[model samples]
Target: MKIRSFFTAILTALFGIFYLPSANAHALYVFAQYDGQVLSGKSYYSDMAPAAATYFEVFRSGIEEPILTGKTDVLGAFNIAVPDAPNTTLKVVVEGEEGHKVSVVADRTMVSNSSNDNFMLLREDIAHLKDKIYLHDILGGIGYIVGIAGLIAWLNSRKIKQGAK
Candidate 1:
């Protein structure tokens, strides 16, 4: 009985450690908008840190090679003059350190007619939303921990019963 309890405890601890969220949750994000002439956007990590000096590539739809390549500024921002290719989609990919990467798609219609102020406001709203950790996320983690603990307990009980026979 004592050995079973110890094993159960160890299994629970391992599951808890593995399932709990960490700082590096692989939540890299890239957002971009095209305003007729220029394409601009930002790249950020889950903690809202700027992915400064990160390499970025822009590829047109149906093209295998990148049409433009550059690095983000200190604020995780980039701007490039997009060739006037109407009705074509452009994909912006940002690659950060430690294998972190993300992509966003932009077309001529994204911000071509919108005002600059509106675009900034939309960007700020998106960034704020991305930084949030919802209550459901916490509850889901707890549920996983509980479920793993219950499974470990059940398996331990079955092993003890089999040993008795």
Candidate 2:
């Protein structure tokens, strides 16, 4: 009986861990572009909601210090005039509530080659697809846990029956 209770407790804990909503559910996402003069982008959550008033920092590649810092507007949009640094890559980080944060690297060549509107739309679609994949992975993990738990229970039951015989 004691061993059965212990197994039950372990299985319960495993199920709780797998089913509970995690911080990543509201993961932050930021997308930015450098247009030779200004750096602009939007910050959003996994649910497609805008991450308004989030703090942002812009750093040059390979540099620890941030060259510019600001917060997103009510619409989760921000624009910063980048210094005249030709052929430089910049990293933009956006941090939202509850330590949720994301970053994107942008270069002049990359931005100039893509249309901003279309790129932004594509990015949003990609985010949604990633969220779907994450959910499927979680469900798959839960299935594996259940399968292992069932196998353990079956083995324990068989052991008790053999002992009685």
Q: Which stretches of candidate 2 lie over 4 Å from their true place?
A: 1-25, 84-87, 107-115, 132-135, 154-165
* Candidate 1 residue 150 C-alpha distance from true site, Å: 2.7
110: Cα error in model 2, Å: 3.9
lDDT of 1 by residue, 1-165 (tens): 966886788677556655765623656777887877888888887767778899999999899999999999998888889877866889999889989878889645444455675665688577759766676876787678778878998999999999999
Q: How many collisions per candidate?
A: 0, 0
TM-score, cand. 2 vs. native: 0.64
107 Cα displacement, candidate 1 (Å): 5.3
Number of the top candidate by lDDT? 1
Give the alpha carbon lDDT tens digit for every residue of 1-165 in model 2: 976896788787656656664523567877777877788888888767889999999999778999999999997988789876865789998889998878889645354555677866676566556544465676787679769878998999999999999
Candidate 1, residue 34: Cα displacement in angstroms equals 1.4
lDDT of 1: 0.79
